[model samples]
Target: MEHSPVRKLLTEAGQRQVEARIKAAEAGTSGEIVVMVVEESSRYRHASVVGALFSSMIVAVAVGHFQGGDGMWHFLGVFVPLFIVFHELLVRFAPLRRLFARKGDMADAVGKASLAAFYAKGINGTEAATGVLIYISLFEHMVRVVADKGINEKVDPDAWPELVGGIVQGIRSGEAAAALSEAIDRCGELLSRHFPIREGDRNELSNQIRY
Candidate 1:
């Protein structure tokens, strides 16, 4: 779990707080809330590599042109190794690497990844379909709430955007765990109202923070 993208930014105490919130949130509801945080949904290396090479080519051309033939050779000589290093560095660096991807593309990536997680984590398999997934993809800076059909049909569709907004703000403020817990609480209230825990209601999914 520690090696998972979800664990990259959270502290041990923060992780525990998130777990506690999940437990508390489920107390009155049969709905299952699963939190999945990730460093990135995709490597997006293709975009990053293209961006790096394009920028390097421009720089090399511009610098070489200004310096004359000798300068061009020198610039190319220097840039080859520098570009290699830059490419590697850019691939790992979020702010720079992200430039390679469009905002819409990132959003799309996040949506696809979240949907995959919804099924992979067994949120789709919950009894009564009362499962909700809070998915955070760090590189794209996106947060999505995925609810199963039961909750979706019972709750208002407009209700979640505001709730998700709160969590997004919290995460932007570097309050990863707090933001997740808050979102869980908000979702829990909705679930409790619509799907109050019945006798013999069981936890269909594990409460541990997923990466």
Candidate 2:
């Protein structure tokens, strides 16, 4: 686990708390819930390149003004090194990269990452198709909740937005663990209503928060 990035969202104690919540939630239903946290869903390299070039151009313009020339050599002298430096900075610093990335692109990245995580973590492999994944990308400040087909066919589709909204708000308010606990409880309630615990229900996935 990358401790620094997720420390705010889940501390050591909070991780245990969330795991306990998952256990409690699963006791009432056959559904499996997995919460996955990532520093970033995607690198957004294009955003970094664009940001670097744009910033380098502004500095190069100032250099050209003082150097009294629109000469190619003059521009390249300042622009090339600066562009390299800025690009490296953007790559190393997620907040800078995010500053230049488009909202739609970030959303798409998170959506895809969440789906990938849903499968990667084995949530999709549950016997009853009663798995749910809650994915959080800290750099993007985005949350995605993915439910298996079994739950989707029975639960109201409209309810997802509110579920997602609460987590987003919790993230903004620095209460992600609490909100996620509640979300798990809600998922449990919904699952219990549709797929109550069976005679030989077994845990099909890990309860730990994936990092």
Q: What lDDT score goes with residue 200 in model 2?
A: 89
The global Cα lDDT (0 to 1) of model 2 is 0.88
Q: Least accurate stretch of 10 residues (summed lDDT) in model 1?
A: 64-73
Model-by-model lDDT, in order? Answer: 0.85, 0.88
- Using lDDT as the measure, the top candidate is 2
Give per-residue CA lDDT, model 1, range 1-211, as digits (tens).
6577766768889898988999999999999999888889888887777877888887777777786746556877957876787798788787888888888888888999999999988899987999999888888888898999999999998998998888889878888777788888888899999999899988889998787
Report the alpha-carbon TM-score of model 1 versus the true structure: 0.89
Candidate 2, residues 1-211, lDDT tens digits: the string is: 6555567588788778889999999999988988888889999999999999999999999989987877899799999999999999999998888899999999999999999888887888989888988888988888888999998999887877787888889779878888888888887888899899999899999898887
Among all windows of ten consecutive residues in candidate 2, which has the lowest summed lDDT? 1-10
How many collisions per candidate?
A: 0, 0
- Model 2, stretches more than 4 Å misplaced? 2-5
